[model samples]
Target: GRPLRVHSTEDGPLRAYRVYHSSWLRAAVVAVTFSHLLLALIEPRAGDGESYYTSFGSRANEPPDAVRAGLGRDVLWAELVMLLLYAADNMLKVYAVGWGNFFSVAAYSASSMFKTEKWDVLRIALVFAFLVEVIVALSTDVAWRPLRFLRPLFIVSYFREVRRWVAVCVKMIPKVFEMFLFILVVIGLYAVLGNLLFFKSGFYADEELQNFDTIGHSLVSVFVLLSSENYPTIMNPAFFRPDHTGSVWYGLYFFSFLLIGLFCLSNLLVPILYQAFKHHRQRLALKNHVRERRALLAAFQELDQNRNGLVTLARFTDLVVRLRPDIKKGDEDAATIAR
Candidate 1:
């Protein structure tokens, strides 16, 4: 037989969060987020990152102007409309939260501020997003089209970890940018040095000069060297050729660039990412723990025979013994478990 049912209060405190508290509403928000994400995924950027047109190619043989005829024509305006919807949704959430806390606010507004802070962050982010969208929408430059791709942020509202992942990326940007600057400086410095050393070694220098004569060319050469393409052509003259200086230092130059530019910079990214993922994992573990605790309590509530808080030991014993006949009443584990 099933365990007795009761309205015992031992289950837990009321789980009445104001925003997205309704299951149906939460599901709706998730569905909307997924739809927005799908729209974002299908909409391809115009060639060279232009914004006005995109493709939803169903076939490789589709015409070039396929996007201009279909979703691309209206996708831009549609995105703006979606942004408006998101803003309105956020606004409604704020209103609901405020009203839910109205009575408590009258009594102790300062202490009760926690209730609305989540919505406040949401509102601010949405407002900023709206402003940026409007600016890009009104702009006439091709560059602004790429900014439209940022619409995927629509998913953040539905997924907590996505939001935190973005936050961590934002926080790590400064350090990562600093590393980028360091590498840029290294490339520029090496480019100059290489051009000076190899720019006009001899008559053969002209033949050897694919990307080492000018500053811009040297920059490209250094970048290409990092990729290690046609590397033997660049180094052979400096070391093996008879008219060459025969100084093996060119090997050291390229080697050091590979060492500092590629190796060191890659190592720096690992820890920042590790810390972010570790923090999110810990958060997920805590979230799962609370959910499991609630489920266990809910199951216990189903077994509680009376409306009063605790389930008596007699009911627990009867329930467990019936559920598991192998565990006799006299077994110490069963007795302890029932107690």
Candidate 2:
């Protein structure tokens, strides 16, 4: 049997790893990425000051506006700079982790790969879009800019905390699907019932198809009613006939649907999501704790110079200084805490 091999930071170039993990480098990348997104928003909009005819007219003869179609000059340059930086960032990671380890599908366990490798591929697509826009601008009247709105997705990847939240949300996908199916089933049942009870009831005008005239129409109406919007419009017709002769019993059907669908079932989603988030957070914390303990044990074993199970205070302080050189060597408190 073959042993399961695992790759870690040690497999990569140490110098590149240090530079990749440096605080200042991450801050610079984040700042540039955010500026790229900000510039995209504040750039001029299409037809802001033009006449109605020109603004809303057929675009067939109108000259292509590269800024409106693809990316404005301001955003284009920013995006170019950011993509270069991101590309460099990926290069550094590849150097640190090695090519096979960096791009391997099995390496997705490293959470950083969730954004890094995927976004690298997305960046390649974006570069192709940039080239197409440039070619179109130089050769034809048509604008084929694909980088207009997608450049901002990379910005979220720079925030480590946000990345974790996104991972948690991804884990909640199954639960979300379950909730969606439950809602669909409930809506289907109510739609069939509504169609049976309200078909040809004359509460809806002959011209209006939005009423429960068919199963499909009833489904759409009930779905809308589940949001509690236009409740009087839907309920008033059912409670009082078109001729103004009716009974209060019609109100019970709507009241029950609202009680179950609007108030009860819809509200179930909040707690389900909350519980999923809470569980994810706890699991993450536990995983981090276990990893920390393993790392600490490994460090302690390495620091134990002798085969015996103890480390000197001096050695521990030296280890601390080696790991965090920013700590002053003369700080006795750091050594004391190390003891």
TM-score of each: 0.50, 0.71
Q: Candidate 1 lDDT (Cα, whole model)?
A: 0.60
Write candidate 1's Cα lDDT for 128-237 as tens digits.
Answer: 67657555644642324444555555566457667667766676666467666776887899999988877776523544345577888788778766666766666565
Q: Which parts of model 1 are misplaced by more than 4 Å?
A: 1-19, 40-85, 99-112, 115-147, 173-185, 201-210, 227-247, 259-339
Worst-scoring 10-residue span by lDDT in model 2? 1-10
Error of 1 at 189 (Å): 3.1
Scored by CA lDDT, what does every candidate get? 0.60, 0.67
List pairs with backbone clashes in candidate 1. Answer: none
For residues 1-339, could you state the per-residue lDDT of candidate 2 as single tens digits? 111122352534656767887899988877877776786464433343443223223474586464454434444455566667776886786677667875667666654432234655555566556546545433543333445577566764556566687789899888678898998999999888888788867786642656898888888888878988776777777775657666555677788899999788889988998898888889999998886776677667878969589988788787777556568667976686687
* Model 2 regions lying over 4 Å from their true place: 1-15, 39-74, 104-142, 145-152, 206-209, 240-242, 245-249, 324-339
